[model samples]
Target: MKSSAITCNNGSFFNVFDEGMSLVCDEDLQALAIAVIQTEMKAVAKLADRIDRQFVQACHLLLDCKGRVVVTGMGKSGHIAGKIAATLASTGTPAFFVHPGEASHGDLGMITRQDVVLALSNSGETEEILTILPIIKRLGVPLIAMTGNAESALAKLASVHIDVAVEQEACPLGLAPTSSTTAALVMGDALAVSLLQSKGFTRDDFALSHPGGSLGKRLLLQVSDIMHRDAEVPMVDDSVLVSKALLEMTGKKMGMTAVVDEGRRVMGIFTDGDLRRMLEKNLDVHATRVATVMTRPCTVIASDILAAEAMQIMEAKKINALLVVDENRHLLGALNMHDLLRAGIV
Candidate 1:
């Protein structure tokens, strides 16, 4: 039986039997993985240098576009284009992906003079994309081309060409689109974020586009939306007896009560913990005033703030509840950790 030598990172060799059997050590696999990552990193790093006048022009066209951005590509580039479109749309730009092949078959109508066309092709000469170039030109839409070949037909025809050329593919054989695709993806993110900043896009704007999950609940749900209102809020007069405040807390099941002054301004807070401390002191519940035993200057939140902010305050203070008040320190509502949990803000 004859065997061949396959060199590995440690200056050692592995056996490749004539029958096609091979043994790969773990060290060799790890080394190859690290090499791929390093190659892709270099590819992405080169894109920073390409962010010049051409990049600015592309951003301007996208920003000035009255209609949505139509991103088109073929094969693997198509997949990257789809993700780029999604990122743009979610970050404040109105954009969507249009398959080049589909565009040739009537989907080109999706692109108009008001829209901007962003095309991706590592080779700069994808046939499907080229097929629709004439129609896109006829529509008079601005064409932004991303390709590896600076002199390719697509680049020459583009209103602005972004050079995403990589020195080499990360694949050892240089047969795959690993490095090139990574560079293109990073460039897409750069464009999306640059436009995001230029347009003053905000977290509230992002929440509008994503309102179905926990993210939406965190950003869109306000303290006022979830807090218990006037009747449900556990509150008692500051001069009330500790026994009376305890009854309010028990009936409300909030484990706490707000002690308000005669004018309805929050004076203090009394919780189950306060009750336990009072018990240890042997204070007469019927004779002691709630103000004398309550926790003074308790944490309170405004009604208009996000519930997520209220959660942070509670977590940092190591408390389970918050009193919702207005600018005048008047009790408006109350909420506890359970409220946040139920609203999915926690």
Candidate 2:
């Protein structure tokens, strides 16, 4: 009759009942964990077999829709329906979710003749959904239903039905929505991605939808947008003394400077790291030309390449800062890791 005692060890918490009856007793916990994972995995595996012509028809319907996709559900299905709508909207398909109960009130006005309806219900007999079924049909809107019960009223009435039946629930009592919900969510992702690819949705398109986030910066920011421009670009004639190059590097504070010929084309680069090696070889900074000590044929990026790509090249080449060059190798600007960090592309 005593309350369970909870304790933390090695970053995990465990519960102890009277007489050391552990809530997370190793054997029981392992069995429960494996059962949950296996149950959900099996549910997803079942979907593989269900992906026949119905799946293709559903995708085609969504792809060809001239207007937005309207999604609706009740309770737990409502939560999953919202996520599906969001995925579709963010991936080039316009979609929005409306609660079925609200639809009975006045939200039904949101649906237009050009819109498609998607409904979710595990039992496929949700009263709120069924109440509005006649109206949706009379309006001639194409209805797609995701449900476990093929015989349920909602499924039978839908233009296309997707089976999300799971053999069992991950919940020990078999009443909680565990495996069924996971299956529905996965199916939503499958539909969204397929539609995205069919429409040729590119990364740039996704970035436009998510312009306020870091992902947008990674996809939309080019080297030209963040690189040091005009006089801020570190450059020196190739014939300049290595000592003079060091002065330019220090003044610019980018730890490097581009070595350019008379035509202002990049010939090489000199960095603090190069200075260290030059000192080791007893090269006279005063007497040595920047060309003799510079790292020639250095890494360069086009001004138009994504800043994210520039970060990749810098990481791979084991260097910071790159000369921004034209297709013909004329120096346009310069960039370094700090620029990427500041631009939120790091």
Candidate 3:
């Protein structure tokens, strides 16, 4: 095996394998990885300069779109376009990816005059994308082009062209779509986020689009949505024996019971923790009233509050359960740590 020393940008020397080299050391591999990252970083950083008037026009076109933003690209650009479309849609912009090839097929119907077209082609000369340009123009929809070459046909024909041209590819061979694709993706994010802010998109709005995941559960799930309600809520009269309150807690499996008055207004709460303390004092459950040992002014939440907020309150208070009540102190429901966990909010 033979290797030669090469000077890195940091003025440090590292080994590079010779012609017959069949294996490389960790240091050489790390150096190559670092170079790739540095190249991509520079490419992304250059995009900051491209966020000029044309970028704003592209965003305005997308914002004013009455229908969905139709994104199209070819090959690797298509994959990035799909991701960009998803991000835009999830961020409150109605958008979907249409492959350039498919758009030339019957899928071109997906693009309407009300929609805005966003086309991605690194060389600005993807044959598939260029094939659909005439039809897109005939539809009279705004076309936003992302390409590397400003003089390319796609850029010249576009309503607005945003340059995603990179100085070089991260690939040593310089033929692969490495840094260029990243620049396009970042530029897409810039457009999507700008549109999101312009539309005043909120977390609740995002939750509507993502209702099936844990994120939806955190943002959309409320205290009332998962609380034990009606007959499921464990409750006992303040006049009841601690032993009877224990039975209510056990039957409901909530580990706690709200002690209410004759009017069904909550006075306090008794939990398994209280039972442990009662036993330490040798207090007889059957002889003692629940109100005598219950915690006064226990933590309570309203039904309209988010379940995530409830979790925060519970964690901060170091308590495992909360009583849901009306503004008039009327008991409505109950919940515990187990309930949050069951709802995937914990």
Could you say which candidate leads in lDDT?
A: 1
RMSD of 1: 3.3
Q: Say which candidate scores most in TM-score.
A: 3
Query: Could you give candidate 2's per-residue lDDT for residues 9-73 as a string of tens digits?
Result: 54455677687574774556788899899989988998999887888899989998999999988
lDDT of 3 by residue, 101-181 (tens): 988888999899999999999999999999999999999989999999999999999999999999999998899999999
lDDT of 3 at 74: 92
What's the best-to-worst order under TM-score? 3, 1, 2
RMSD of each: 3.3, 3.3, 3.8
Choose 1 or 3, whichever is better by TM-score. Answer: 3
**Clashing residue pairs in candidate 1 (N, C-alpha, C atoms within 3 angstroms):** none
lDDT of each: 0.94, 0.92, 0.93
Pull out the clashing pairs in model 3: none
lDDT of 1 by residue, 1-346 (tens): 8988887787777888878586776677789999999999999988889999999999999999999999999998999999999999999999999999998888988787899999999999999999999988888999999999999999999999999999999999999889999999999999999999999999999999999899999989999999999789999998899999989999999999999988889998999899999999999999999999999989999999999999999999999999988999999999999999999999
Which runs of model 3 end up more than 4 angstroms from their true locations? Answer: 1-22
Q: How close is candidate 1 to the true structure, as a TM-score?
A: 0.92
Query: What TM-score, over all chains together, does every model reach?
Result: 0.92, 0.91, 0.93
